[model samples]
Target: MKGFAMSTVNIYKEFTDQKVTENVKKVSVIIPNYNYSRFLNERIDSIVHQTYPVHELIILDDCSTDDSRMFIAEKIKTIKDIPIRTVFNETNSGLVFSQWQKGLKEVTGDYFWIAEADDSCDPHFLETLMKPFDDEKVVLSYCDAARIDDDNNVIRENCQDLYNMFDSRHWDKAFVTEGSEEIKKYLSVLNTILNVSGVVWKNIPGLHDIFEEAKNFKVAGDWYIYTKVLEKGSLAFSPKCLNYYRKHTDSVTSSVHCDIEYKEIVSIEEMVAQKYELDMETYRWQRIRRSYMDANVSPEVKKKKIAWVIPYPGKGSGGHRTIIQNVNALIRHGYECDIYSEDDHRTTDEQAAQKIDEFYETCAAFVYVGANPRAEYELCFVTGWQTLEMVRKIPAKQYGYFIQDYEPWFFPMGNEYLIIEDSYRRGYSPITIGRWLANKMETEFHTPAQYFDFCADTKIYHPIEEIEKEDAVCYVWQPEKPRRGSELAFRALKILKAVRPQTKIYLYGSAVDAPVPFEAEKLGIISVQECNELYNKCAAGLCMSASNPSRIPFEMMAAGLPVVELYRENNLFDLPEEGVLLAESSPESIAAALLEVLDNKEMASSMRAFGPQFMKDLPLEKGFAQFIRSVDHLVLHTEYEQPKAEQIYTRAPYKAADEFRAQALDILYTDEVSSTDAAPAVPSLPRRALRKLRRIAGRGVRMIRQRIGKQ
Candidate 1:
């Protein structure tokens, strides 16, 4: 069966944009034939039936003893459309490289394909292969291939993976990149661009010098030529297996010549390392290690691991709970999991494991912050803004983010805010908790986010058997954390109590033993069971989250209670389901909304019923299920360096921190600007505070600089 796929290269330019270079239209096809007269007719037929037009076809015979001379002479008569050229050698050239150099001397075309006489291809081979030349930097482009016997019976369905054994399956996907990047990563160790019969490269001037150099090696001539030509420019790769590579008992490559091929492979790698200025020691070590692993390692015995960088898990922290859940889910999916906490030097791995048992009661592996275990992980999850620093210190093949919330808004618009904001722009794929954060991350920041919506554990937080309501309203209040909007919530509650003097108010989630001109019950942090019971006792509940929709709102809905929240993008985008009331972020708007729920019995009943139904489709396991699926797909399908979109903040201005701080203070304190020619001057932080902030911020700046340098 033949497979077809359009490359990432846009096709309009190749056919209709009229900006296509004339070089792209001119393709010189050189067929080098030996004793394979039986396969010559099939090879010629495949090239003749191409969907894309070719400029010329040259058939060179290397003193073949078979009837190939008579067969080609008769077959050349039926090909009436394209320009044809033929070369017959008086003596056997003995080397295929000689025939190639001979045929290239007589050809004049922008690109060339050495279509071996024993191979066959799909009609779309040239059409797909030539698209990459539209990029002037691409020196070569190639496709995947299938192995067939002399009778055209399939031997191997896809052989590209067999060649790409050191790295992951890079050839299974399509990419267009600079040759230097591809060379240093994948090509430095082995020739992943396999099967010259399935390849095509540009007819650049200096390329012939590399061909002459390749004549030095009898076994790995193609490998030498590919490595040398790539040094000139970029390359394009297609995963479509369109070429048919014939393998027979008498094929030249059938016998193993390990000693010679190994020496040549090392020599070519050394040349590539010097050309790209790669670390010679690292290159040699990696080459030897990869060769060892390729020979000794088996897929069944391979140890797969996933690491997580998280803050120490404490009670009542939703983010920590989410991390534990993710670890448990990954463990269930047959991965050994590791957790690294920040600034924990005292606890050993066993002690950390004991702590996890006390809190989450799971058997997943644990690693202390400074333990520094030795194992190669397939992926690492950077769970917070600070974790990016930890990730910078760790080594992993693939990196991702478990963005629980947008942490930048947690601080005022200052240096800390800008630093936290910069963490999202570090080019890691983010799997956010809700659609609101996902959309915000993807659209505003231009970094794509995979959204995983959450659902509650119905078994734990279910409605009571009998419906009952008390004369009190409850609010999850934490005055110290300003993002909870405690001051605004208090004002709204004061207004709410004045109108309905008979009902009582209850505050929970924090212990604020401060003075207030109100009477209420304050329940300091309660357990999951107690919170569910409190929801059943209250007539209405209020929870405020300015950054992301908190889990408490869903918990309240699950317990069959009506909830009131601020109508912000963070909430509106995620909690569009019924059973919740959204009010503008004002005391008056919130008080009116609470009154509407308490005053009408019919609306209350409908909201209580809508809560459970809205949450039914969202089972508690759905988020983790999606999370594991995303992790698996990203590890197997995506490139090591996933493509990054254009960033939003071009001039982030963090270097001028003092000026930025003063301007931010001006904007925060003063409502209007003065009509003066000079810029307004605001007070800066104290000298001691400035020094401390700089010391903390210096690390982040260096990290950003290092990241930029690598790019």
Candidate 2:
């Protein structure tokens, strides 16, 4: 079957047996009323006094508390020429489509008009709309509409002109076009048919199933039903301005929430795209343009929107936590924010939204897992190196970068590293998470950057009690990740164990499946509360990173646990004090630092006293304030390009390509993933024991070389 581009001439040719007759077509005028008593008389008069003849009229009252049922009952006494049937619902069905279904089942006419209770049509509405059905292929015919206020004064002259702004082909001219072609081009994007009162549909068996399917949707049911009915035959457009769509504060469409409506539109478009195999790029552009138009915002009062393109937040990731925090902070300050991720990590939209609600419960930022619908934000912020490439293809007024760490260091000194390094030089204003990164970007790349301090949640990770401290050492161990210096930490822990064999060892952050040379308790992938409890019990904490400092040290300090880490530039920039013992990346240096904090009680006490106070000083609010100030500076200082039609259309194919790449990668690299279900626990060794093991291994190698020389 042809999905989209069916011809009207062919529709008529196929139905040649059902020949058109000279007699006038019987019309069923369905008036579904609900509390529109003030306009009911006018609506009834408009239909009964049509210039053309009607065969039957059906009036359904959806249990309105208003006097509409009584009003309609009395008005029927005056309409003697047309056969009329009246039914008052016992209770409200809560859906307008339900009434349409009821009226359709009883109607015996060749065509049906759902004349809404609050709207009125011109005297020639039925006559003008029914003329196109002269050809048996015309299953649906609708006229252009005039928007009117509650008092019946015209608000806009022609609604079709605004509807046709994006496509400029069909509504501007009258045509009896194929149903599939009409839906593929226009109706797939948005409901071009302005009102139910303006439409006249043929009573076919296919329309019943369409109405049933439409019942699943509340806000965009009419649009869905219109698309399905059009697939049966052809659509006829009458440019005669014969219908007036009434806009009021209390109407059903006006009362529904805006997000729900947009979400429903997205759902409908996805269903249509899969069914018809339409050009996804065109559909994507249409979704965005339609949203901009549907916002109906005047140019004067519109606020700017921003989007953050980041990776999917797999379990136990500090990067994901920081991104969520930044987004929530921006949203709290009245900036509308949205998050888009190329990889969803096998998460559904509902599951992602729920997780977002759990993390930043106060904010209502949207999370899109796959292809981002047309949001048309004023600014786009790229949060990761891979996302920088995707954001380039996404349409936005201005672009910026959210730099947490130098991403090139995550890879080796090769092609991937160079590509990631080039991402920083894309001419976007950079927002850094720490002062060291800010200074590095400005000095090396000549990119003037805005920087914010890293902070921990003291409310969740605070000193519990003096009694909670135990003789246990905690380590943030992520073994598979080479950048965390897991081997260095394990060697140091081995040394610490030999010197202090009585101390208990605990590990968290991830689970381990591989064999390790030492023993420790693996409390894998824990919640914030459990993590805080573990930190409170431990006397000292170990955190190592080859590049920037990990968030684990700050969190450990918030729980009053003294931390030992590599004395890298990134760590020295933040924790160059007595609270955190610093050492070189060598196993000996790390082991000595860990032993100093673990063995000396007075030094441990001094560090513990300073830990919580230092973390308490650098709260999330301080960082958020800096971030907002930088965003405001850029938004006010930078000039954004005006939106153009060609830009939006040209950039749509990138998302499709990105989706293909993500799927191929998922198939190829199945093992190198950190999904929540498959994450492994990481193990660690003690401090002084690491030195003994190294000496033993060195002696064994020397003995083997001596034996080879004798041979």
lDDT to native, each model: 0.71, 0.72
lDDT of 2 by residue, 1-711 (tens): 011132111111112222224567889989999999999888887877676787899999999998887888899999898999987899999999999999898798988999999887777777778888888999889988777778766667668566755656567778899999878877777788878999998888777778888889878999988888887899998776678788895655342355566667766766776668554334434535434645644333334578888776566777778887887666545465777776546888767766665643323466677546457777789888768667876677788889877789989899989988887787888887776777778778988788777788888989888646778888888886777888767656655554566777787888665544345677887888998999999989999866676778888888889988777666656663667877756555566677778878998998888888888887778878778888887776643221111111111110112222223222222333222334322322243433333334334434423433443
Q: List the residue pairs that clash in candidate 1.
A: none
What is the TM-score of candidate 2?
Answer: 0.52
Give stretches of model 2 more than 4 Å off: 1-294, 344-348, 354-363, 371-373, 638-711
Q: Which stretches of candidate 1 lie over 4 Å from their true place?
A: 1-300, 344-363, 371-373, 511-517, 638-711
Global Cα lDDT for candidate 1: 0.71
Error of 2 at 14 (Å): 59
For model 1, how does the per-residue alpha-carbon lDDT over 584-655 read when each residue is reduced to its tens digit?
675556766787788888988888888777777676688777777778777767332322322221221112
Error of 1 at 356 (Å): 4.4
Among all windows of 10 consecutive residues in model 2, the one with the lowest summed lDDT is 645-654
The lDDT of model 2 is 0.72
